[model samples]
Target: MSILVISPHMDDETLGAGGTILKYTDAGEKVYWLNISNTKEEYGYSEELCRKREKRYYEVIRRLHITDAVDFKLQPAHLEKYDTGEIINKIGNIVDRIKPEIIITTSPGDVHSDHKTVFSWAKAFSKSFRNPWLKKFLLMEIVSETDFALPMGSFIPNYFVDISDFLEDKIEALKIYEGEMGEHPFPRSVKNIKALAVNRGTIAGTKYAEAFMLLRCIEK
Candidate 1:
């Protein structure tokens, strides 16, 4: 199976779908990562920070065993500044090239503007009639962003994947993003990630799990 994960930033994937991704790759499936936004050095971010972020990105991908990845390098926190149609067309081109069986992406209801923009373009490009090869469309939950969304756009997951065996691997991969994780109260902390996983697991009757909103699925 071919799985494509669309992330708004470098660490979003690891925070959201890391364990499930590890499970798929462990089963010999092809997993591709498409990151839509980045912290560009020219965006007033220090060169040192950009370099550090890039290095952490490589380390995370290496640990996840994902060999196929693409970074669009668009400026972070300003994805909406780009033309929606242009972004959708660019993403569509990648979809046409990969022809993935499943696509997991950031949620439209996420609190972060970048996440919402990524979801918008990703959803536009993955319409069933436009891409029959894409059998499943799922929206992953990112801590610190998805949880903080307004009640009207709150994430209500209808799908769950047990990541009990791979939970540790997921946490380890996320650890590479040293700048992202923080203390116990921080939403992106490792403790809370595990807590959320366990909570989702309880709903799915597993020891640890990742939750997603199943936007669509087609069985052949």
Candidate 2:
């Protein structure tokens, strides 16, 4: 089965569903990453940082053993600036081409506008009538964005994946995004990541795990 992970930004994938992604790839399942936005200099990011981040992104793909990846090249944190129909069409094209049975994306409750926009696009293509190939649709929690989101939406997870064996792999992939992680107290810190995993694992009866909200599921 093919799986498509929609990331609003580069590191969101790692921070949100890295371990679960590793598990799928390790099991010989095809996983594709849909990178929704770009890190551009005009977005107040330095050109040097952009180049460095791009290099890291490729390294991440290598580490994750993803089947392939597609980049939307849209402006970061400014997805709202684009025409909604245009952006959705771009993502829809990818969905049609990939025809993935499973789709994972950032929670709609994320505080970041870009993440919220990406969630909308993901939801649009996830309807059962729109994509009969789709069997599962999940919303992953990006530490910083999900935790900091307003109470308009809650992320009470009913799905959990035991990522005990792949926890270290997730950490290693996250290490590549040095600029994204920070010391203790930062939501994306290595410590916090592990803490969340352990907590979820306890709930899942494992040593470490990743939690997700199973938004949609079809037995077929």
Candidate 3:
């Protein structure tokens, strides 16, 4: 079955479900990545920095063995500026082309506006009958974004995937996104990533795991 992962930014897919991605690719399942947001000059990012980040994204795809990927090139953090219908249509077009059996995207509760916007559009398009190829929809949690949204919203994961052997691969893949990693207390830090994986794995009785909030599943 084909799997599509929609990411709001360059590293979200890796931070959210890198290990699970590895498991799928290793199992010979086709996996595609769609990144919706792009860095903007107004965001104070230099062109060099943007180029570096783009390079990191390519590195991530290479690490994951992903052959199909697209960047929607939507302005970062300014997704709210675009009409919702337009955004949904853009995603719907991609859905029609990919025809994935499973779609994973950012969580609605994520603190980042870009992530939330992408999640809303993805959820809407995936549920529409016009796109019947989508059978499963899941919401993945980003470390800093999802965790910081508490008190306003919470991420309560109901689905867990064991990544016992792929946990290290996830961490390594995330590290490819230069300048994203932080120290121990930082949510995006390698230490915290491993910690969260271990915590989720403990709950699921595995050595390592990734957690997701299952949105929909149609059984054949």
Candidate 4:
């Protein structure tokens, strides 16, 4: 099977589904790692910092032996102009090219601006295209460091996948976002991910699992 994972930023795919990607790869399936934004930003970097961090992100990915990784090289914040239709078309192009059996992406209530935008665009692209290979669209949470990530007022989970077997890999992947995280004080960061895994595992009949809000499924 072929799969496409849409990440808002470089580390998102890993933070959200690195273990699942590992699972798929172990099962001998092709997986595409696509990030919608560029790694550089003039505002956040002092020329050298950007260069250094960019190099490290790739180094980490390569070190992890990730097979397919695409930055898309889009502007840092996704749109200089902020046109939703343009976002849709761009994502549709990727979907058309990948024609994946499974599509994984960020969630709508994620609170992160880029995360929300990616969710909107992925939903639009999925509906706009009629790819028969597209059977499942899964939403994985990233940077669930806020109250919005919890079982909030309206957010509900549709399913969860056990990642206990790959929790160590998830921590390693989150480390790839080195510059941004920079020694987070909140133990809840990785702690929450693991905790969620255990909690979800109980519900899903596994030792540890990741939660997802499934958007589309063609059949059971």
Best by TM-score: 1
Give lDDT tens digits, candidate 3, residues 1-220: 8999999988899999899999999999999999988775667789988788778878889999885999877788888898999878887787788788989999888888888888878888566377677788999978999898857578999999999999888888988976778898978998899899999999999999999998898876
Candidate 1, residue 122: how far the Cα is off, in Å: 0.5
Taking every candidate in turn, the Cα RMSD to the unseen true structure, in Å, is 0.9, 1.2, 1.5, 3.0
Q: Candidate 1 residues 87-166, lDDT tens each?
A: 88888888889899999999988999999888888887567789989789999999999999999899999999999999
Off by over 4 Å in 2: 42-44
Model 4 per-residue lDDT tens digits across residues 1-220: 7888888877777767777877777677888877788645654647776687678667756644555667765666644346888767777777777788889998877766777777777876465257777888898856452236545523466778767677787677676666455433453367766776787789889998777778888763
Worst 10 residues of 2 by lDDT: 147-156
Q: Which residue pairs show collisions in model 1?
A: none
Give me the runs in candidate 4 sitting further than 4 Å from their true place.
Answer: 41-44, 63-65, 75-80, 145-153, 179-188
Clashes of each: 0, 0, 0, 4
TM-scores for all candidates: the values are 0.97, 0.96, 0.94, 0.83
Q: Given candidate 3, what's the lDDT at residue 105?
A: 95
Clashing residue pairs in candidate 4 (N, C-alpha, C atoms within 3 angstroms): 161-209, 161-210, 162-209, 163-209
* Candidate 2 lDDT tens digits, 1-220: 9999999999989888999999999999999999989878878789998899789879999999999998777888788888988888888888899899999998888888888888888899779999999999999988988888787777888899999999999999999988788999988898999999999999999999999999899996
lDDT of 4 at 84: 82
Model 1, runs deviating above 4 Å: none
Q: If both were scored by lDDT, which would come out higher, candidate 1 or candidate 4?
A: 1
